[model samples]
Target: MNFNPVEILGLIAAVFTTSAFLPQVYKTWRSRSAKNLSLTMYLVFFTGVMMWMVYGFLIDSLAVILANIVTGFLTLILIYFKIRYKD
Candidate 1:
C-alpha cells in the first residue's frame, strides 16, 4: 500500500493525539483514583470517537481508523476505571 504525504502526516498526527491519553490512563490506573474524572465528558468523548471511527471506515482512512481504535480502547478502560473505582 502506497501512502501519500498527506496520509503520512495524518498518521503522525494520529500518533500524537492517540498517545495523549496514555499519561492519564497510567495515572488513573496507578493511583486507583478516578474521582476527578468526569463520566459525562468521557462518555461523550467515547461516543464521538466511535463516530469518527465509523467515518474513517466509510472514508477508507487508515490513520483515522487506527487512531480511533486505540483511542476508543483507552477511553473504554478509563470509563471502566471510573466505574470500578468510584468514590
Candidate 2:
C-alpha cells in the first residue's frame, strides 16, 4: 500500500481532535450522568462539526467528512442524553 505522509498526518490529527470528546461521553454513559457537561458548548460544538462535515464534503475529503459525521452523531447523542437527564 502506498502511504502518503501528509494524508496520514491529516488523518491522525483528525482522529485526535475529533475523538477529544470521547472520554466525556464514555463517562456520562457509564455513570448515567450528564452533570457538569456543558450543553451550550456541546450544542455549539455540534454545529461546528456539522459545518466541518459539510466543508469536508465540498472539498471532497472523505476522511474529514466521515470523521466529522461520526463525531457529530456522538455529540448529538451526548447532547440528547444530557438534556434528558439534567442534574
Candidate 3:
C-alpha cells in the first residue's frame, strides 16, 4: 500500500490516541479499582469511538478504522471494569 505523508501522520496519531488508554487498562486490570473512573464519561467516549469507526469505514480510512476499532475495544474494557469493580 502506498502511504502518503498524511496517512503516516494519521497512523502516528492513531498510535498515540490508542496507546493513551493502555496505562489505565493496565492499572485497572492489575488493581481492579475503577473507583475514580466515571461511567458516564466512558459510555460517552465509547459511543463516540464507535461513531468514528463507522465514519472511518464509510470513508475507507485505514488509520481511522483501525485506530477506532482498537480504541473502541479498549474503552469497552474500561467500561467492563468500571461496572465489574463498582461497589
Top-TM-score structure, candidate number: 1
The number of the candidate with the highest lDDT is 1
lDDT (C-alpha) at residue 79 in model 1: 98
2 versus 3: better lDDT goes to: 3
Across residues 25-82, which tens digit of lDDT does each residue of candidate 3 receive? 9999899899999999999999999999999888878899989999999999999999
lDDT of 2 by residue, 25-72 (tens): 788988888988889999999999999999988877766777798889
| Every candidate's lDDT | 0.94, 0.83, 0.92
Runs in model 1 with CA error above 4 Å? none
TM-score of each: 0.94, 0.82, 0.92
Model 2 — TM-score against the truth?
0.82
Alpha carbon lDDT at 5, candidate 1: 91
Q: Show where candidate 2 strays beyond 4 Å.
A: 1-3
* Residue pairs with clashing backbones, model 1: none
* lDDT computed for candidate 2: 0.83
